[model samples]
Structure formats: C-alpha cells, structure tokens
Target: MDELKLGLDLGAVAEALAAGEITERQAKNASKFINQVKAVHEKPLKARLIQSDRGQFLGEAHPLDCGAWKAYRYGPEFRDGGKVFPSLEDAEQFIING
Candidate 1:
C-alpha cells in the first residue's frame, strides 16, 4: 500500500471507501495517519490573558481556527462560559463583563 501523504483529506478517502475503491483497513489507516500527522503539526491554542482597566487579571481568551474566539473566566479553574465571540476583542469584553 502507498503511504498516505500528510494533509490528506479524509473526505476524499471516505468517498473512495464508499465507492469500493479502497478497503476498510486502508481507509482507517489513512484516517489514523492523517490525524497523527495533524496532531504532530498542530499546536495548542494559547489563551491570551485579559486584564482590567486597573491592571487586574480578568480571564483569558483563546483564538479558534474557525475565525472565532473563546473566553474562559479565571478562577480556581479556567472555565469556558459556553460562548464564542467573533473576535478577540469581543471575547475579552465578555471576560471583563461576565
């Protein structure tokens, strides 16, 4: 079997599998290999600390890959408030206000 290249789209592989062009094992292997490669190359999103006007730490905001930002309130544990913002500024505001 040919080695699957990095960044292979699993959608195409699924289509191939459904079309009976590739075996189930081959499709699973391709998916696993692609995910492994993605995991190795992808880095965790670092949350930027949000501060108040008085220089007090509010919380943190992490930018997502989908052009959105997620805010987490700082406390005993960093917890997401179940809200997604369109921009980092919006997320920071949420952290500050909430």
Candidate 2:
C-alpha cells in the first residue's frame, strides 16, 4: 500500500516517546491524534461515497454488469436492492452530482 501524506509527524512522536522524552500519556494522546489524521488521509481518493438514509442518491461502490453498473442497498427495506445505471460514468456522475 502506498503511504498517504498525513501532516502528523507520527515517526518523530514515536521516536521521542521511545527515547523517554515524552510521557506515556503524551504518547497515548499522540496516538489518538495520529489516528484521526490517518482516517482523513485513508478515505478513498475517488469512487467511494458516503451512505445516507434520507438522501436521493446512489453510492459509488456499485458493481459492473453487462456494461452497466448495479447498485445494491443493504437494509430491511428494498428487498431486491437499488437501481442500476447504464454505465460506470453514469454511476459516478449520479453519485457526485446528485
């Protein structure tokens, strides 16, 4: 996996903690901070949309089928799943624009 460019200097913080320069509490706090930073950078670069309940849109995690994209909503409602788009472009366009 390629390294994501997170602004948090996790290496220096870990090094300082290991060298006894920072307390265990400081290290723990730093770990928590780094996790937040990691989450921001770890988000998908593209083609990943957030799932919303009361929204009128489709997510980007759809599957390709017969040159068309099929979207499935996993919930108690919608027994047969969601709608289908004619192409991947249609899926992404609807995902972002809608």
Candidate 3:
C-alpha cells in the first residue's frame, strides 16, 4: 500500500512493533499521530443532491465511513435508503438510473 502523505506507514509501524523492531512507546506515538491525521481529514457527512442533465433532481449521494459511496432515492423526509457503490461514479450512476 502507498505510504501516507504524512510520512507515516501505519501498517509498517504495526509490523515493526510485532517484529520487536520498535519499542511499544514508539508505536504508541505513531498511533497517536495517525489518529491526529485522521481527525484532520475527517469531514462531516452531508448528502449532496444529484441532478440529471435536464435539471431533474435525483436523490442524494452519501459518502460512507467505509470509503464507499451510497446512492439513495428520495425517501419520506429525505432519508437515505439505497445501495452502496465502491466509487462515486457508480453511486452517481445508480442515482441517475434508479
């Protein structure tokens, strides 16, 4: 996997800890930094409305916590209720089609 832009390889850190190549304290520090990075990158989840070429309002696409996208038809009170797609393109397609 690609190393994080912060120059921390979390997977490598865990592996090094398991292999006794780094002290527990060092691993803990790395973990802390990783969590900080996550906090910085995290965004509040908000659904954006999808529109068709003719300006017809589709439903919404939600960014899932697991790094997937979800497209849902408009439910009562604008609730999300649909399938998850691996990419935003797929989600948009589903929103446009279904």
Candidate 4:
C-alpha cells in the first residue's frame, strides 16, 4: 500500500467521508476549516475612484450604495437599512453610471 502524505487536505476527505461515515470530530474540524476558507474569500467589493472638480472621493461598489441612489433618485426608501435590493444588476448600474 502506498502511503501518500498530505498536509491540511481536509476539504476533499471531509466531503468524501459522507454523512454516515464522518465522525463527530471530523465534522467539527471540517466545518471550522470550511468557514475559515469562506471568510478568507469574503472580501469586500472594490471601491469606486472618482475625480471631479470637487476633487477625488472614495466610493464603494456595492448594492447598498445603489439602493440608496435609487431611493434618492426615485424618491423611495427601497434600500433602507440594507434590508432590500431588487438585484445586484440594479446596484451595479448605479455604481457604473454615477
């Protein structure tokens, strides 16, 4: 038998172990690792850089901004408190157009 050694190869093994075969310890560890990976990838959206007569500003490219813009533009509190967004497409439009 070939003993292939691997370091931190929990992703594949944890997924392949299946529900019945995975022990409590493995489940806990796998969940932790998976969450860590998720957090690492959950980077914030890029900020929009603008230069105008007023000078430069640091703006964000996000749905909340778009929602607020929409609300302000159309006179409706649609994206209030970050609770609602019709779609990212609408949000993205504001980001680009503004």
Q: What are the per-residue Cα lDDT tens digits for candidate 4 across 1-93?
A: 001012334555465456456666666666666566666668654433433346543133333544432212222332342223366545445
TM-scores for the candidates = 0.49, 0.35, 0.48, 0.27
lDDT of 2 by residue, 1-98 (tens): 01211347777677877889887787777777778877767873333453556764445445543666754444442365556788766655555545
Q: What is the C-alpha RMSD of each candidate to the true structure, in Å?
A: 8.0, 8.1, 9.9, 10.1
Better of 3 and 4 by TM-score: 3
What number of clashing residue pairs does each candidate have, in the order they appear? Answer: 0, 0, 0, 0
Task: Kindly give the stretch of ten consecutive residues in candidate 1 with the minimal lDDT sum.
Answer: 1-10
Ranking by lDDT: 1, 3, 2, 4
Query: What is the total number of backbone clashes in candidate 3?
Result: 0
Clashing pairs in 1: none
The candidate with the higher TM-score, 1 or 2, is 1
- What lDDT score belongs to each candidate, Candidate 1 first? 0.80, 0.58, 0.77, 0.43
- lDDT, candidate 2, equals 0.58
- What is candidate 3's lDDT per residue for 4-96, written digit by digit as tens? 325656887788789897788878888788877777668655777899899988888888889898788765624635788998888888888
Would you list the clashing residue pairs of candidate 2? none
How accurate locally is residue 45 in candidate 4, as Cα lDDT from 0 to 100? 46
Model 4 Cα shift for residue 12 (angstroms):
11
Q: Which stretches of candidate 1 lie over 4 Å from their true place?
A: 1-44, 80-82
Which residue segments of model 4 deviate by more than 4 Å?
1-18, 44-98
Window of ten residues with lowest summed lDDT in model 2: 1-10
